[model samples]
Target: MTRRRPPRHASADELLTELGRLTQQALERAELQKARVELAEALQRELLPAELPELPGLRAAARYAPARHGLNIGGDWYDGFPLPDGSLAFSIGDVQGHDVEAAAFMGQVRIGLRAVAATAADPGQVLSRANDLLLSMDTRLFATCSFLRFDPATRELSHARAGHVPWVWATPDGRWGLGEDEGGLPLGVLAEESYPVTRRVLPASCAFVLVTDGVIEGPAFPITAGLDEVARVTRAGVHAEPAELAAAVIKVADLTGHADDAAVLVLRHDRPPA
Candidate 1:
């Protein structure tokens, strides 16, 4: 004899009612998630600088954009701190992931870099020590950073980059150049890699624009396209103030399709007061 199939567990109406209940539960859960995300975004915004440092003979501005995912708050930070010798240390960095954990790690990385910079007084050495510190931390997390040491008195600037984007320097003579660094892998990935150091004497009226990759990549435009757009927009306004220039570049990214968090730091040397 043929075996009979088992009876349906629930009638059509019953199934629909169950599904409605499930949907309500999911909606409630989503509401909770949204609240958490709002809280996180507010907290992350607090971490960002209230105001860019006001250094004599310089104009500086910074911007940090949070990812649209809502749950992902990647640590994209810029800071200007002073070293023991009175030189200003400027830096921008991004921790690997976009979440609460990443934010915390970014804070730690910033602190470690500051400590190393104060102790070493060399751009390359500071990054090297930061690399070691990252390697010692959680193995999965990594960070890309660009560190700058600027001496306003002497008009000297030294830099080191770790897998970060190229910094653009626009000159008073209407020429633009990319900052040169030997470059190395992002921190926390390798145990003993070394970062290269480079220096330059920024001209009066010259400005350096440093940015994170989030300013460039998304679904509509590829990374190269975003970068090219940045170059084009930035090259167009080489004489604008640091803040205006940064806003211009970021507006292009926003228009293009920068889904992830983006950060831009502008440092321009100006004439000293009489």
Candidate 2:
């Protein structure tokens, strides 16, 4: 006699309960992740300048690329704003971490540094003050930054670097070299240390390139090779305007496998000879 198969268990309520719990958990996780992403993106946007500062008699352009590897954007940032003395204040920096908190801290440091730079008029002093500010704050992040006070009249670039990548300059004659700035310490580090400012007399038709370490520190190439590529690209675009040159350099950097967040700012001196 064929035994009647035990009636299939029909616990629809129990099944529905399990499914509801799973769905609720999934929704909660999705909401948390979305909130985190939004927070990180907002912080990054706040850290960067909304628009490049207006400078009379000079043309400037910038390119920023966030890394493609994570939920939180990296800390690379570029900024340009007019100093109270009428000179252009230009800078690029990267905090050590990449997250919402890092971005927020970076925004605070960037604004504070700009104010300090305006008042101090000395890059080293400004950085020192920024370090003190960082130490006083709850955030314990560090960053490498380069600051330049550009004079359109004399084509002089007064610059200082705090553990950031060295800048490059391409003269009108096609000669290219690093813009070497002397002693400096990264912000949010030792308060007693100071940075040395270096001045460069750019050619009337020169192009100066500033960048963050993300362009040069990733895999597939060493930092030196990345710099060499930059030098090459700057020479190739020697005849282009600052904005055009910056675009070209950014393209080349991306092609060379810059997998991290990267930024480039180009300054082209075009004042007619007085």
Candidate 3:
């Protein structure tokens, strides 16, 4: 005790060395986070569709813009595929959270949907099976999704919602409308949740738009404002091709900070052969 253990102090060089080691660890962590983000972006590009499916009597286009805010890479997703039952299926969804976990889960959910669509004839039934599939996955996350089944031959469409936004429809004949699909609880929340199928007869040259909540309820843009803006721009772009129409709708959103990701999938009903 008298010696005092040389004041129980560390050498200057030793302290400096420890500081350096800590700084190195911090740098390593930063690098790891960056790598993860890059990986997520690449995975998203692979997972998301580069082009919409080719369906009869419909011109389809889609756009996916990731969020610009912190860790904005998230679970927003859209899919358009042809079912074996001779109908075109389109869906848009957002899983909870905005991290790599959510993105990975989104991939799983989308794959489940595509597989279930093959046999399920009704949009509501498709969603019900998808919900059960998701529940079985045991992921501790929920998602909102909207599914639509369109029969191009009869100009008929059926929509199902799982706590998702309604589709916006703008007609070439100067008619603007919104889907009447009823919303149920989000998927993975309840095993017995039932989605209602709402059917409508779409008119010729109608641009039907599907979007996530982020697309309509951003920090700067309220839902009503965003809806009005999208509807107006979509109507104005009604004569444009599907690709241009999607771009126009996105631009009209005027996204800033990208606090949340946005996806727009549009299927324009083409006039039948003369």
Candidate 3: worst 10 consecutive residues by lDDT? Answer: 250-259
lDDT tens readout by residue for model 3, 1-274 = 4654556688899999999999999999988878877776777778887667767678788888877656677789988888996788888998888788888888998899999999996989989999999999888999999998888677788888999877788887798877756878899999978998888887666888887877777777777677777787888888899889888777644553247888888888876776
TM-score of every candidate relative to the true structure: 0.90, 0.84, 0.88
The digit string of per-residue lDDT tens for model 2 on 120-150 reads 8767777778778887885678988888888
User: What TM-score does candidate 1 get on C-alpha atoms?
Assistant: 0.90
Q: How many backbone clashes does candidate 2 have?
A: 0
Off by over 4 Å in 3: 1-25
Computed on alpha carbons, the lDDT of every model, listed in order, comes to 0.80, 0.78, 0.82
Stretches of candidate 1 exceeding 4 Å from the true structure: 2-6
Cα lDDT over the full model 3: 0.82
Write candidate 1's Cα lDDT for 159-228 as tens digits: 9889988877776676876665678888888878888888877677777888887887776877667767
Tell me which of candidates 1 and 3 scores higher on lDDT: 3
Q: Would you list the rank order by lDDT, best first?
A: 3, 1, 2
Candidate 2: list runs displaced more than 4 Å. 1-31, 54-56
